[model samples]
Target: MGKILVIADQKDSAIATGRGLELAARLGYSVDVYAFVYAPLGRLKQTAAERNALKQRLLEDREAEVQARIDKLSREGQKVKLKVVWQKDVAPWVVGHCGKTAYEMVVKTGRRSESIANTSTDWQLLRECPAPVLIVAKKKWRRTQPVMAALDLSSRIAAKKQLNATILSQAIALAEAMDEQLHIICAVEVPTLLEDLDLIDSRSYVAEAKQAMAPHIKALARQFDLPLKAFVVKRGPVEKVITSQAASMRAQMVVMGTVGRKGVRAKLIGNTAERVLGQLKTDVLALKP
Candidate 1:
């Protein structure tokens, strides 16, 4: 694995450094902490212009606070090198910076009070960044906790197969690194259109979905050397089923995937990944293929 780009958003919420650092240590990935200051200088146009020294002092103070947070985490015996970058316009900057390096993953605190109309920087990065993203939760978890991997066997796109594999592989690796159990789940829900289309049977579709996912689940189990019991198949909208599965299993983290590049229905429909994220209270490791 390469270095991980950690977006330290102290302003949004307390940086969940423990989970991020633990993940980096397990993956053996160096951490580059990017702490962006959102507060404009002096918070007033006239004050910023007249009180240049005061503005400078404020900027320095803000940077110091962020640096202090990073320093505190770095000292806790994490075997990862840590570096920091401070700037403004954090989200767009981070998205652009992703193209400059081959970072294995981008870790950040999940956006606060997020909604369709009010999406946050983390959501933007999840949609745009080239690297995989790990949205750490405010609630901390033990170093070793169960993780659930969400699988969608009904995707028609050829690339979805690659995405599923990437999701499972990372989840498996993390489970091994932390000495935690990895649960694989396939959530199937018949779409509303299924009833409208001719020759479409909801019950039969559910059965076929399970049948289709069986081989892939079995293959992943063998590859990861996981027991058959680790795999599960659920029926419901992913927003409900994925979270329900994770909660039931007491998973501290969930590894899933999103479509990075836009597609035909991308504009018309909200990302299912976002819906799942909204429902879960645990940390999420998102990947793109």
Candidate 2:
């Protein structure tokens, strides 16, 4: 297959890079590790020549550091490439780079402290990156834990329906490669106005929702050969249900979809999946359509 792009954060957690290496080894894909470093000019109170010299020194130092880290993670028979760049805005740079190059996936570590809004680099990458983005958490995967795929089954839109398929396929591939089980989860959200107007009981609404989704779930089962025990249907806010199910099941990763667009709609994952990411402690594989 194609190569995987591993973005190394300034913090150098190694979690993202290490995960990328592991996936590359398993999937037989080459890896391109990019370490970003930037030095603010305002912070340096020196002559122009001195500032330039110091900046060059900083770049050399960071390159050496990142090289050493990659050398430690290197393995025999693995095709790995490394690049060190002085880019302050990593997300946009990556988006531009990926637009030019083809990669199977973009792997990066996520910050749990980011807000639910689409403001962080991770959120931007999820919305704009051409390739699938895998946001890794600090927690390591356990052998028995499964990879969860969260689907928006209620959406009648064709794009969303196709996105559900994409999410499932990616999750299945990852689960198989990792030798882990695959679990499917879908949340049915009831309109608040129905409850406010007393038009329908919450239980009734949820029951109806599940009934409507049964055929789609069955179709998925037939297409993917998923067992009944592998499915989980819950009624609640999408983000809450996903986070709860992932935690309860001790999932190693939660695969979900994000709509890649511009303007207001670009905030697709921010509305639901972004919230889930904010609360979830497990790794996430975000697909785009």
Candidate 3:
């Protein structure tokens, strides 16, 4: 596996750096922190000297946080590095940098608020990040338990499948590294309209989905040579199915992909992958294609 790149916000909560460092230590992977500094509003309208001072201060603050996090990781036997980047569009810049770097995974903290109106930096990072990204929220990080990889069988997007496979691969690798179990779950959504029409014979659909997923799951299991379990759920909404299953299985982390759809297309039709990210309490590893 390549190095893990953490795109950290200098102004947001320090949880981003803390989570990244913790994961790096647990997984035995080196960490490269890209600390981003947004241009100050006053500096945007200030004199050259004043703007320069503001920029210097921002850099200094960011550097201090980065160094502190790096030291913490070092105490845990992790090799850590820091890079300070001054960019207005930190999301795209981080994505482009990850594309060029030898990084297999990217970690960042989740948006502060879940309300739709309150769009945080982590939300933007989730939407645009290229690598398989982990959004750490305010909770105890589960490091030594099974990681859940949630698979949505409804969407037939090719990119989504590829991204899901990437997440599964990462989870399996992490589980192996940590000597933990890995669970692969495909959440099957039974349409309410079908239920209303008394056509909700979900067994066939569940069986078919399980059959289709069998080869992939077996191949992964064989590749990893680890204990793997697969589950096909045929009830409730995608988010509920995933969360309930993960909770039942006592999973430490949930890994899945983000389907890049928006507006009415995202709402009326909806994307289970995105909804699962929003609803789940487990640490999520969301991949963007």
Candidate 4:
């Protein structure tokens, strides 16, 4: 495991910090907590005394809270380092710094609702950040439960195999570290036109897909020397199918890879992995390739 950076803001720092520490402890990784503060330049243009006073107060407040969180984690047997950054562009700063650093993953909490036209900094980080992002929603995180790795077998990109494998491996390692179960899932979406034309038998297609995925699943099981739970193959919107399977299986976390496609094409066409992140009720360990 590499360094895990926890990105937080003034309002959500405590929860995010705590969650990051927990994850680092489970994964046996070094943890660093970062808080981004918006320090207005206009304020700096004010009287020297006023500017100094405001800067001093902000620094003192941020330091106290950060230290408290770090101390709490230390008491819990987690060694965490904290840093407070005064920056206007939180998302860009994270991306730039992470690109230069050796961090393998960035962990943060996700908001419930997002606007169609605008998104939160966390959302932006998911779309554009250089490092892999794990967004933990507000719920009881099951440290010792099954993790579902959702895959798209039909992706045109040949690189997907490597990306998917990394996702699955990480999920399995996490589960093993926590003494939990790991399940692999693939959503087989049959186009409505093909179904209507009867050109492809949906049931047969699903079966064939499952059969093809069997070899990979078995290989993983053999490598880990663990019994492989049944592989799931369903026909529907990939996002819905993945979420339903994870929920029905009572998975603790959904592991998957983001294709990194962007703009109107990605939005109009939609990617299964991205859509699942937006809709899943459980925490997501999203890898970028």
Best-performing candidate as measured by TM-score: 2
RMSD values, in order shown: 3.4, 2.7, 3.5, 2.7
Q: How would you encode candidate 4's per-residue C-alpha lDDT over 52-89 as one tens digit per residue?
A: 78877887788787787678654465667778877777
Candidate 4 error regions (>4 Å)? 41-45, 75-77, 140-144, 197-199, 223-230
In candidate 1, what are the lDDT values of residues 1-289, reduced to their tens digit?
A: 5687777666535455656666777777777766654445555666545767755666677667766666666646654543444466676788888888888888888763464355577777878888888887775434436978887777767788778878888888888888888888888887877667755888898898888878877876787677878778888888788888887777888999887534334435767677777777788888887
lDDT, candidate 2, equals 0.84
Tell me the lDDT of model 3 at 193: 91
Better of 1 and 2 by lDDT: 2
Worst 10 residues of 3 by lDDT: 112-121
Q: Which residue pairs of candidate 3 clash?
A: none
**How far does residue 183 in candidate 1 sit from its true spot (Å)?**
0.5
lDDT of 2 by residue, 173-272 (tens): 8899999989899999988898989998999899999998888888888888888667789988888899889888889889998765555554433456
Q: Which digits, one per residue and each the tens of the lDDT, describe model 3 over residues 196-222?
A: 787856777667766776776666567
TM-score winner, 3 or 4: 4
For candidate 4, the lDDT comes to 0.73
**Cα lDDT for residue 275, model 3?**
65
Candidates ranked by TM-score: 2, 4, 1, 3
TM-scores for candidates 1 onward, in order: 0.84, 0.90, 0.80, 0.87
Please, what is the whole-model Cα lDDT of each candidate in the order they appear? 0.74, 0.84, 0.69, 0.73
Native-to-model Cα distance after best TM-score fit, residue 215 in candidate 3, in Å: 5.4
Per-structure clash totals for the candidates? 0, 0, 0, 0
